[model samples]
Target: MTAPPKTPHPLLFAPAASQGSVPDTEIGRLFHEMDWSATPLGPVEVWPQSLRIAVSIALNSRFPMFVWWGSELVNIYNDAYIPVLGKRHPQAFGGRAREIWNEIWPVLGPQVDEVMQHGRATWNERVLLVMERNDFTEETYFTWSYSPVYDDQGGIGGLFCACSEETPRVRVERERDALLQRAQGTVTTLQGWFDNAPGFVAVLRGPDFVFEMVNRAYYQLVGHRPIEGRPAFEALPEVRSQGFIEILERVYREGEPFIGRGLRLILQKEPGGPLSEAFVDLVYQPVFDVHGRVSGIFAQGHDVTEQVRAVEALKEGDRRKDEFLATLAHELRNPLAPIRQSAKLVKTPGLTAAQHHWAIDVIDRQATHMALLLDDLLDVARISRGRLELRMEPVALSSVVASAVETAQPLIEAKRHRLSVTLPAEPVVLTADPLRLAQVLSNLLSNAAKYMDDGGAIEVQAQARPGAVAIRVRDNGIGVAQESLQTLFQMFSQVSSALQRAEGGLGIGLALSKGLVEMHGGSIEAHSDGLGRGAEFVVHLPWMQTESLEGGQPEAPQGQAALRRKVLIADDNHDASTTLAALLELDGHEVHTASTGNEALALAEQLRPDIAILDIGMPGRNGYQVASEIRRADWGRGMTLIALTGWGQAEDRRQAVAAGFDEHWTKPVDTDTLQALFATPGRAGSSQAGPAR
Candidate 1:
């Protein structure tokens, strides 16, 4: 059988070797020695040299590959192609196609056979192949081109393929699609919510720019149809003439936002008709682009016409209240002045004992009424500002009650009411302002007298408790209505509806008493069954340790004789000057009266009076000017200058000192204090001068 040399396949020998030339390398010699015709069908001798060279070039050219031929598949390539086959090794080169590529064989082997059977080329084909290279691992996904090799007779032979793994690129594309879908959905939801928002919204470009986007509320406010891509002045031409254009231009140049409150704007609807009006509180905010450059502006606002009108009405009401107070003070004080002066004048000299007592009683009664009115005025001013201060001390409840009853005796007697007073056998002491306690008692007694039409009894009682003292004033008179009880202590608010009744007052007594009591760390309450059943007011104050009592020396008797001296009294009011001069004269001092500042100045220079009393409100020149001139004069330097006026504010006292007055006294001057002033000797009088300006 070996007699005839076996014919080798043309693919197995080198071209030069087939021409009878010898190869130089050992591999070449080994190739020549092998008998290809006698070898097994699946042996390595069947692999062509051309096939090996082609695979090496493909793997070295930056592309990965593998080959299958007639039931055998091999990774006959360079180093770069080896790892792509995963666990498959060089030993797998001659293995059966099923054994080497078991994971991908089911799909890949059939496709390769299909190309070879048809003798056609498959190009740019994509496939998902989960292939196991070794027993341990799998790889998926491929894109490849397959071409069938043809014999010279055009018979199907093998498949030539090239592949690229594309699993990472496919996954990345799918995830990107999902994120884009979510972002689009979120944007749609945000737009829906913003459109239905309650507040007006608009996007503008610069100050006078038209709204690029607007919500429903913005349309309702502007009324006019909006022109989207135009400036504000172009759409609403009236704005140019209304000064809005200038405001916009300035804001754009300055890059500042503008916020305005209660701005009134007029809008035009049509020709030859009244304009539409609006009061707005508006805010402008500068808008920035992603690069942080100012690109536009946003505007929002509320219509406040109704609110502005309401505030104007409130201010008008406040003005009327102030006017009423001024008028009341003027009208009330005019009549009070004459009555007060007449009472004082009636107390003068030489009368029968009965007449003297009658005159004194009349004077006391009128003075008390005037004092009560003045007190009410002061209380209202102080309470309104929360400036009332209480001078708290250990007070004797019984003594305060006694003094109040004595003060109100005339009123009680005039009404013919019986008064009863009850006090603890032991002293009832309370921590309170003594003067304020007396004031509270006097107010209650006065209120009771004013309310009662006929004679009625008033009973006052004081009792001590473990930690507090209680004082009660009970009156048998017309009582407060159930509805009015809650508001009885409100200032300027009267309980009785009858305006023409005998109770003529500013309705501040009870209110002031309540404030004073609370300030002393005490409380007061009013109780009544119903109208006309009678009323009771109870005051409770905390008890504190009592301090030792030192009875103050009895105030020196007023009207005491002093060395007679020439005294000039200057006052604008004739009655005040005359009454003051009369009182000084009775105190054994020679007195002269001047109703004008110039007259007083001339008199002081002429008479060289020992003392000068100047009124601040005199005509020609005020008392301050008169006093300055008198002090500067040679003859008037020795004379004492006293300011006598109704101006009692701290600033007024300061001005008096600046004007060179030796002393300052408020009007309805305390006669006793004045008398004591004249009686005291030396420069002690100068000590009473007020603060310098």
Candidate 2:
């Protein structure tokens, strides 16, 4: 019931007639010849295996090969195509090329079919393709070259293809393309950011170091069109003449980045024209190419014009500060010298009552002047730092003005200038700080007197304006400059250069006065024509009344009887001790003198004086030590200890208080206050003594 398969005859292996039959024609012989030894065909069997051998040889070859039949992709074979097919078996021998790889049909099928139909050959490179293999997997690359195959009848039968598998090459090429695209995008973004950056940026290239790229700011700064692709020397030839080209050359040669800040660059519109200068901070960084070869330089910078100007302003302020301090020291020391000399002269032991009284008064007035100067200095510092404290009270404007005038009278008398005052008969009241008001008026008056040369006249007048009171201080003195008017209220800002030499000041007085006036809801203004003319300052303050009026009377004056008691003075300076003793004696007080704190303490315990004035700085046992010893003494119960020294700082006063002194007074003591302290009713004529400097 089963059928057996038949076996082939041995004779069938022998060469057949088709294999042995050689063509007599040259074309037939050529087609049948096997020139390659690796081919699996004998010379006689080549004809029968011609088509098969040709197809096999083409498949094994490195070149891509395909066959098309008239407008249709029939067969394709290639060694390079093996990998593209991945793990797929070679069973794809006779499939429709288009159907197997339809994804690439749009590009490869259309072009190859056209060549076959038209009987022509076409070649291309970098031709793109996306196709699926026999396994239905996607592949993307390029295919090229199409040659039409003709039949024996001279008609186009099919097309043969030879191409290189460009997938790897194409992928690499796409990556390179992406890198270039990204680089371009980065450059664009950098350009935009640099254009608006606070600093300038530029790119320079070439042996001549020309500017190749410049941002918007660079163009604006250069004030000219960019010179791209031009040599730096040629584009900015003027720089060569100005030595800037040399700097660039040095940087380039060293292959190092260079940075320069606060460099002054003067740019002129035309040669020999006035230079418009600007300060700049700059950096030049070397740029390299793909091969790491130096290609050009990139420069970035900032314009520091404003910064330079501000520094100049600060320098000017420092200069004014120095000048003011020097003037202050000179003015304060001048009065101290006379007070010391007069105090020494009064101690000669032959002084009459009138002469002694005059000497005491002179010492008192000079001491007060020094105190006022120190007060002004402290007030200026406080106002500058916004630390000025005001004691607000209902004040009579007349009293404030009168006090200020009285304080300035010595300076006025020294100048012998005509002084006039005009005040309303009716009282003008204001809710203000009395001491600060007096200080403001005093500063204005003193400033006027200091500026006037040869004792010029001064006028102080006040009037009621709409909702305010206007106080005017007019003086015939060297006037301020027009250019300085705007900065008149600026601290440490002096007048123009011309006026600084004529009238010296720290430039803080007016500034402090202005701030004080404004803090009280008021404004101040300065008016002047020019130098050698006159200046007038006007202060306008709001007029307001305080509600409370009780407890407004001035305190009664202290008596001078205590000042007439015997007083002992001790100090290291013989002139200081002797003059102080004589000055006390002139107040109708018996005086004894010692040259040291120990001597004064000894005399104080033995004499049991009413008061003791101690000098802080002494050779042995300083006045503070002396005062402490005296306060602890059995006879020191009612004795008042006063500190009189050059150490006038606030902390010094606090230390003095802690050391048991009743009051602290600086050197060049005001004789009037000293006399009044001694003259108090309960304390007057009591035995009091003081330590001297």
Candidate 3:
């Protein structure tokens, strides 16, 4: 069919000058200057026709092309392929294909061999290759095709290839993808921060104010409905009537922010649910687009319902304060009136001793009543300020009851109430403030008598339980109203009539009793069926064993051990000074009374008394001054100074010690404790003010 193609002189990658005097193309010019003998393809004059024709096709092609000639696969390429080869240009022209592309030969060599051996064409698109270019290993991508070049006799001689570097396109696409990912992350972070903000926030777009986004707080407030992409009126219809839509429209249209504080709204918690009142501090801020045009309204708010209600509650408390001031003035004048009348009666001519005693009783009773009321008020002050201290010790419950009964007896007799008493057969002991416990029970008993009509029955019962003792004070008098029972012990609470309030009712005795009982690990509760059905006040105190004293000193004296000692009593109140001196003398002690500190100091130096009891608030000089003066005297060195004060605060006790007093006692000290003070050293430390001594 064919007389075999013309056999070219040599298969040189570099064409000879005779071959159109070397190709005019860029690769041809480069090939002619290159040394072909240095390659396996030898010289330009010796290249075979198949190799020469392949090189010619590569050199003249507008597309990128490469040619490998001879058995060693020597390289030759076109001008368009120079940029694809990168820095491997002129030097690669005469080198073997495998040697020139050694960085990628592992993959390229196999493709070339497939085309040369099978006489087939192979194509690879965007094949990834790591190659050295510009002194660095570059991540490169290329599209390539390889075909076998046949010689004059139709036998394979070398490989020819066409390629395009896809690196630039691939790099651009990768950069765009990275940019998009960064944009998405930024948006997600901003959205997250908005959703977790402390206050509620939402976004509504368009003239219709379509819901675009809502934070968790805003979503919860609006009933957690599917609101996105919906109009505000459609999603939250009720809020439309509440002016929310009107404000949103104003913000969007005017590009201005709207703020509404303490705005009241009636809103439903869920769809089709009952509406409830709420208050909010709302803000509607306009969101702007890149063009600086208003695009949407950003709604933000906070719930202030509790803050609003607290303001209302404060107003109510102010109203109560005014009422309490009015009640207090009326109550204080009640005792003053009786005392004044009794004083005038004592001045009457030819007054019988019995009549004088009656007047004295009236004055004494009224003064004592006023003193108890002041004590209750002071106790409340200490309780509220957390300055109250408890002197706790183990004492017999029977003894506590007897002391409480003694304190309440005057009030019960004054009211002419029929009193009944019941006590446990076994001794119920407790670790508590015995004085405070007595005060608590006495307050409850006195309160019952004060509230009850004359001759009304009152009961005092003590029951010992497994772990506690309960003292019950019940009266068949004016029972507490059902509503009043709940707040009966609340401080400054008003429930009683004007008459009851005038009868020395500060409305804090029960509250003070509760506070004192609780300090000693006890509880008090009041219960009643209704007003006039009779109210019952019960106090429960933890029961403890007396044997657990653990070798400690006895809590109190067991029996009366009267000691005769020379004693001086000082008080501005004549009745208090005389009454105490008389009591001391009755116990077989030489006693003297002083109406002031100067009188007491004179008596103390003359008598050189074993004990000097001084009143803290006397006229000429206070008890502390007298005690200091007495302690400085040589004759007063051995005498014990006991301070009597109306205030038994911790600071008061400290001042007493600094003034050289050996003991400090609050007013109206128990008769038994006073006698014991003569038998033993009193509680001496500044931090203490009890009968421990």
Residue 208 C-alpha lDDT in model 2? 76
Q: Write the per-residue lDDT of candidate 2 for residues 569-685, one digit (tens) a residue.
A: 667788887888888887688877777777888888888876677788887788878887876776775677778786655567667876777777766677777877776755532
Q: Model 3 lDDT vs. the true structure?
A: 0.79
In order, how many clashes per candidate? Answer: 0, 22, 7
**Highest TM-score against the true fold, candidate:** 3
In model 1, what is the error at residue 568, expressed in angstroms?
2.6
The estimated TM-scores of all candidates read 0.50, 0.59, 0.74
User: Which whole-number lDDT from 0 to 100 does residue 38 have in model 3?
Assistant: 73
Superposed Cα RMSD, model 1: 16.3
Question: Which candidate leads the pack in lDDT?
Answer: 3
Off by over 4 Å in 1: 1-371, 386-395, 428-436, 465-468, 497-500, 551-565, 595-610, 619-621, 624-641, 654-663, 670-673, 679-693
lDDT of 1: 0.68
In candidate 3, how many Å is residue 6 off?
A: 15
Q: lDDT per residue, candidate 3, 1-693, as tens digits?
A: 879876544334433555553457767667767877876777767767677777767776788988887778877788888887777777777777777777788998778778888888998999899999657898999998888889867888888888899999999989999988898998899999889987888888878888888889887666667888999888777777887766777788789999999998777778678987888898888889999999888888998888998987677567666666666666678889989999999999999999999999998877777777777788888887787888887777777788898999988998899989999887677887878989998888887887777899999998987878889999997787887777677776657542354354666777899899888778999998887778899998888544244464365666756667878889999988888888788889888888987888888888887777888998888898998898787776567778887887777878888888878878886667677766664322122322312
